[model samples]
Target: MALTGKLEIDVEIKAPPDKFHDMFCNRPHHSQHACNDKIKGCDLHDGDWGTVGSVIFWSYVRDGKAKTLKEVVEAIDSEKNSITFRVLEGDVMKDFKSYVITIQASPKSGGEGSIVHWTMEYEKQHEGIAHPEDALQFAVEISKDIDSHLTQGN
Candidate 1:
C-alpha cells in the first residue's frame, strides 16, 4: 500500500455557505459550541483569526479518546470559501509524517444551503498504519453538527 494517501468527503448542509466558511475561518475557536461532544475547544496561539500563518490549537475527542492538535493556517481564499490547515504538532504526527486539512464551502444551486468539502492529505510513518478514515469521519460529524447548530439558530 502507498504510504501517502488522501481522503475527501462532501457534506450537504442546510446552512448558508458564507456562514459555514466564516465559522471555520473567522471563529474556529467557537466550534466547540456547535459540537461540544466532539470538540472541547480551539484557542488562538498566535496571529489573528481568518488569516494565513495564524497558529491555532484544537482540543477534541476521537473514537472516545481525547486528543489535541496544533495547526497553522496555511491558506485562505475568500473567493472560494476555502481554508487550509497544516498540522504542526499533535498525536497525529506520531502516525503520520505530515498532514494537511482543507475545507471548502460552496452555495448549493437553486437552494438556500451549501456543499461542504473536506480533504485530508497525509503520509504515514509506515505501511502498517491504516488510512485516516476515522479523521475524515470526525470532520464529517463536526460539519453535520455545525450545520444543525446553525439551522436551529443555536
Candidate 2:
C-alpha cells in the first residue's frame, strides 16, 4: 500500500476571505480566543508572523488528549491568500514521517462569505496507520469558530 497521502477539505464561512487569511498569516495566536476548546494557544518561537521561515508552537486538544506541535512557515502567497506549514515535531510525527498542511481562504463565487480550504499531506511511518480525517474535521470546526468570532460584531 502507498504510504504517502493527501487530504483536502473546504468549509464555507461568513467571514470575509481577507480576514480569514489574515488570521492564518498574521494572527494565528488569536485562535486561542476564537476557539479555546480546541486551540489552547499558539506562540511565536522565531522570526515574525506572516514571514517565511518563522517557527511557531501550538498547543491544542484533540481526541480528548492535549498535544503540542512545532512548525515552520514554509510558504506564503498573499495573492493566493494561502499559507503552508511544515511540521517539525508534534503528536502527528509519532505516526507520520513527514506532514505538511496548506490552507487558503478565498471569496465565494456567489458573494458575501469565504471558502476556506485545508490540505494535508503526509507520509506514514507504517501502512497500518490511518489517515488524518479527524484533523480535517477539527479544521472544519475551527473555521466555523473563526467565522463566528470575526462576524460577531458585524
Candidate 3:
C-alpha cells in the first residue's frame, strides 16, 4: 500500500521514432483527428505546442467512461525523442496527488519500426486508490492511433 508508484511499458510501432516525437512535440492538438473514439479533444491552454511550460487540456474516453485532464509540458528533448507531461487537473487529479507521464520513442536496433516507451509516476491521494493501469493502456492505444494516422501514406 505504498503511496507512490511507477508504471512503465513499451509499445512497438511500425513508424519511425521521429514520427512519434513530431506528433507530441509539434501537432498534439490534432491527435483527435487520428483517433476519434479514444481522444475527443486536445486544446492548448497556455504557451504553444512543442515548447516547454505549455499547458494542454485533453478530453478522452478511458475504460468506457469519459475522462478529462490537463497537463503542462514539463520538457521535450528532440535528440532523445522524449517528452514529459505533468498532470494538473481533472480525473487523474482526483485520485492522485501528483502524476507525471513521460514518453520516449527510439529506433529499434536493426529494425524498421520504433519502440515507444511509456512511464507514469504518481503519488496516490490515499492508500485505497489503485494504481493507474488503465490509464497507461489508454495512452498506448492513443499512441498506436497516432502512429497509424501519421504513417498512413508513408
Q: Which candidate is the best by lDDT?
A: 2
Q: What lDDT does the true structure give each of the candidates?
A: 0.93, 0.95, 0.92
For residues 1-154, could you state the per-residue lDDT of candidate 3 as single tens digits? 8999999999888889998889888888788999899889999999988999999999988778999999999999999999999999999999999999999999988979899999999999999999999877887898899889988988
Screening candidate 2 with a backbone cut-off below 3 angstroms (N, C-alpha, C), the clashing residue pairs are none
Off by over 4 Å in 3: none
Assess candidate 3 and give its TM-score to the true structure: 0.97
State in Å the error of residue 2, model 2. 1.2
> Which of candidates 1 and 2 reaches a greater lDDT?
2
Tell me each candidate's TM-score.
Answer: 0.97, 0.98, 0.97
Model 1 gets an lDDT of: 0.93
Candidates 2 and 3, the one with greater TM-score: 2
Name the better of 2 and 3 by lDDT: 2
lDDT ranking from best to worst? 2, 1, 3
How many pairs collide in each candidate, listed in order?
0, 0, 0
